[model samples]
Target: MTEATATRTDAQATAPAKQTKKVHLIIERQDNPNSQPYTEEFLVDYVPGMNVIACLMAIQRNPVNKDGKPVAPVAWEMNCLEEVCGACMMVINGKPRQACSAIVDKLQQPIRLKPARTFPVVRDLVVDRSRMFEALKKIKAWIPIDGTYDLGPGPRMPERDRQWAYELSRCFTCGACVEACPNVNERSSYIGPFAISQARLFNAHPTGAMHREERLEALMGEGGIHECGNSQNCVQVCPKGIPLTTSIAAMNRQVTYYALGSWLKK
Candidate 1:
């Protein structure tokens, strides 16, 4: 062969081969609440703009693992395909967040998925978030306006309060705060930071404030604000950036005053 052709052939032979890109997922799955947990590895074709949920959907479509064996499709929950619903929250890479928003490109290789430890695992990535909801119910996290109808617009809150209240209203009970909070584990009855912040949200409303005492009363009971360990993990994991710790302090003051007033009136 000619020298130039020989050099070209040598260079082409030494060049690295193009690698096929694929996403690696290490997911912890459970068949049932009482079932033993197991890990499954999955590999899906990498596509730009794909998120963790998208990767999981790809696996679901195929139901095959990294070993090329057919298996039960990994079970999980998702709604709205947006962050608002908070249905797909899980421990992604050791942080609890919405899977729909977990962009595969932004995540590190061998992305890990597990059910959040704060709640009971239903199956796979699905968890029972009912504890957080129960806390909401315990705090009466809603305004009541049903007597004989014609309640109309109720009352208006001051602009200053309304501005901050709007921020608090963004909470969709996503439970990220609860999941990150160390105080909200199996041993403690802490209502979680989200509930405390939610109590503040409704209490600031003019109409909602009318039932403020009731909410505060609930906050003073078991699984109330007093159970907070002040670890401040809730604020770090909250997707909405809600001022959870500040709300906790605010509610603490309310509870303190509430307890004092109750004693004085007796």
Candidate 2:
């Protein structure tokens, strides 16, 4: 072979190979509410832009562990893969975040997935968020528009206030704030930060402010704003960056005013 031809052939033969990799995942699993918890390891071929949810789906396709033993496919809740639904919240490497947004490339090797411990673990990486929902119910976190009729723009808010209110409206109830909060646990009745921010959202609205007294009263009750430890963990972990601490502080002032007013009324 000619020297130039041989050089070209060698280059073709020894071209750099694509670096394909398989991500390893260690999932904490529980078959049922009453079943004992266990760890299951899985290996999935890497694909560009793959998230943790995609890895779980890969394992679901073939229910086998790292040891190659057949096992039940892991169960999880996911909706709106864009992280808007907050249904796929889980503890990824000890940080609470939505699995849909947890890209494999950004994650550390041997990614660890677990259920958020702030709520009851129903199954693998799926916890019952009913407690937080119940807290919302307890506070009646909605504007009451009585009688089904077109009120036709009942009220309007100032542009500046509306801008701040819009920030509070971004909460998806993903539970990352709750999971990061130390006050939310089995023993404490703290309602968590999301609800407090929500209270602020509605209260800032001109029409919603009619029931501000009721909302403030609810915050004064058990599992209310007083339960907040002010550790500020909720703000740090909130994926939406909803300014939770500000809401908490605002509600704190409201609750204090309510208490003083009630005392003076007596």
Candidate 3:
């Protein structure tokens, strides 16, 4: 064998090993709803196809800080890791999103995760979304169905309307839109964009239309559709890309007509 060829083989064999990649995370944590929140940093080994949730799980297993101190396991909520349940929703890198679907590779370094401040914080990354649920209740966002008896096939809706309704129904009450909106805050009792969209969704339904007048009446009250600032932030941050602004617009028209009809009756 040639001496030059042997020398090249030895050089290739002695090459330095590839360095392991890591994901750096900065998480805002609150011990309880009333406790002061603080920041903690963690380093997690990077794995191919890993997501934000995966990074969190790694921290859970190690429970160590970037300073090498053993600490409490970072608490966060997650379910249906496919991004359907929305339980894993949090402020990721200043944008509200589902951690289960946030790919680690795509996010910028020093990824940040925080609880959505739109709702009361429960702990770490979990927040109380009851405000949205209460809004849904006030709007009567449901179709009145009779007893569980067999009522086969209610009225049918046109294909066009059904398609759009399906889009509005995609809201899982993740509170992303609420977090993005500037109007939703402690001082404001606004029912929020999702409730307005939900009101529109039910008002257009074949069976839900039965309560359409009632729904409109609820919206005409305080914290109804009038509270929206038209900031358009809700649609921009909505992960599902639901037509939130469009729904709010449609409900505005409905409320106007309802108000006019009531005035005429007086």
lDDT values, one for every candidate: 0.90, 0.90, 0.92
Q: What are the models' TM-scores?
A: 0.92, 0.91, 0.91
TM-score of 3: 0.91
Question: Clash pairs of candidate 1?
Answer: none
Across residues 146-222, which tens digit of lDDT does each residue of candidate 3 receive? Answer: 77798888899989999999999999999899999999888888888989999999988999998998899889887
Residues 1-266, candidate 1: write the lDDT tens digits.
Answer: 69999998887787656345789999999999999999999998899999999988999999899999999999999997878888998999999999999999899989999998688999899999998889899999998988886868887678998999888898888788888888887788888899999999999888889999999999988988889988999989988888999999999998899999999999
Worst window of 10 by summed lDDT in candidate 2: 12-21
Instruction: Write candidate 2's Cα lDDT for 24-100 as tens digits.
Output: 99999998888898999998879999999999999899888889899989899999999889999999999999999
Report the Cα lDDT for residue 154, model 1: 81
Name model 2 segments beyond 4 Å from true. Answer: 1-20, 148-152
- TM-score of model 2 relative to the true fold? 0.91
List pairs with backbone clashes in candidate 3. none
Cα deviation at 197, candidate 3, in Å, is: 0.6
Candidate scoring better on TM-score of 1 and 3 = 1
